[model samples]
Target: MKEGIHPNYRDVLFVDLSNGFKFVTRSCVATKETGKAEDGRELPLFKLETSSESHPFYTGQQKSVDTLGGRVEKFRNKFAAFKK
Candidate 1:
């Protein structure tokens, strides 16, 4: 309820640096850049490295891991020891 003591809350863009993805939403987050997204004329744009488009879960490209490695058996043995 105070005046002149609050940060300016406004709409801003959130950009994911890893995949060049960007989305517009109302947020208090501050940034140096500004832009307008008009209703009906706006189309949200986003780019992602894994968005069910190239992910193994969606594409059925899952790979099986070898469980015979010393690390794997060691971990299993460690848990088995605790279980006993």
Candidate 2:
């Protein structure tokens, strides 16, 4: 609530480069880019490498690792000498 000590927060457009998804939200990030939205309004543009639209986890394309099985196999191999 202090005056002249806070960065300006305004509506900015975040564009997902991988999927071309854009959304307007308020942020204090600085950018030198600008773009026009579908509503004919120009807003500050921020580019992102990955977003929910293109992320593997959000898109249900994430790969599941068989870590438990691998660890069990390693343990069995390491303790094989004791079994004998």
Candidate 3:
């Protein structure tokens, strides 16, 4: 491993806007804002729309798919008539 040329890896806070969930993890991502975490540790605060806590997959929430009017399916159905 080389030194001085690599990005600094430090603690970063990922805050989910929807659920107000905050978590600290080590990352190379830089941010201007900083705040003390729930554990009383100072970390960079980064705002995000979705995180593992509020994401549909991780939260086990049923997501509604808008496949009924997909353009690809419509095109395939339209071309299916010519296949016969």
Identify the leading candidate in terms of lDDT.
2
What tens-digit string does per-residue lDDT give for candidate 2 at 1-84?
779998889989999999899989999999899999888889999999999999999999999998999999999999999999
Q: Rank candidates by lDDT, best first.
A: 2, 3, 1
What would you estimate as the lDDT of candidate 3?
0.89
How high is the lDDT of residue 22 in model 1?
A: 57
Candidate 2 collision pairs: none
Worst 10-residue stretch by lDDT in candidate 2? 1-10
User: Tens digit of lDDT per residue, candidate 3, span 1-84?
Assistant: 777898889899889999899998999887999978999988899999999888889889968898877988999988998999
On TM-score, the candidate that comes out on top is: 2
lDDT of 1 by residue, 1-84 (tens): 889998776555554554544566666664555443444333333334554445577679899787679788899888996886
Cα TM-score of candidate 3: 0.72
Q: What is the alpha-carbon lDDT of model 2 when measured against the actual structure? A: 0.94
Better model by lDDT: candidate 2 vs candidate 3? 2
Give the per-residue Cα lDDT of candidate 3 at 77.
Answer: 89
* Ranking, TM-score, top scorer first: 2, 3, 1
Please list the Cα RMSD from the true structure of every candidate, rounded to 1 decimal place.
7.3, 2.1, 3.2
RMSD of candidate 1 to true structure, Å: 7.3
Worst 10 residues of 1 by lDDT: 39-48
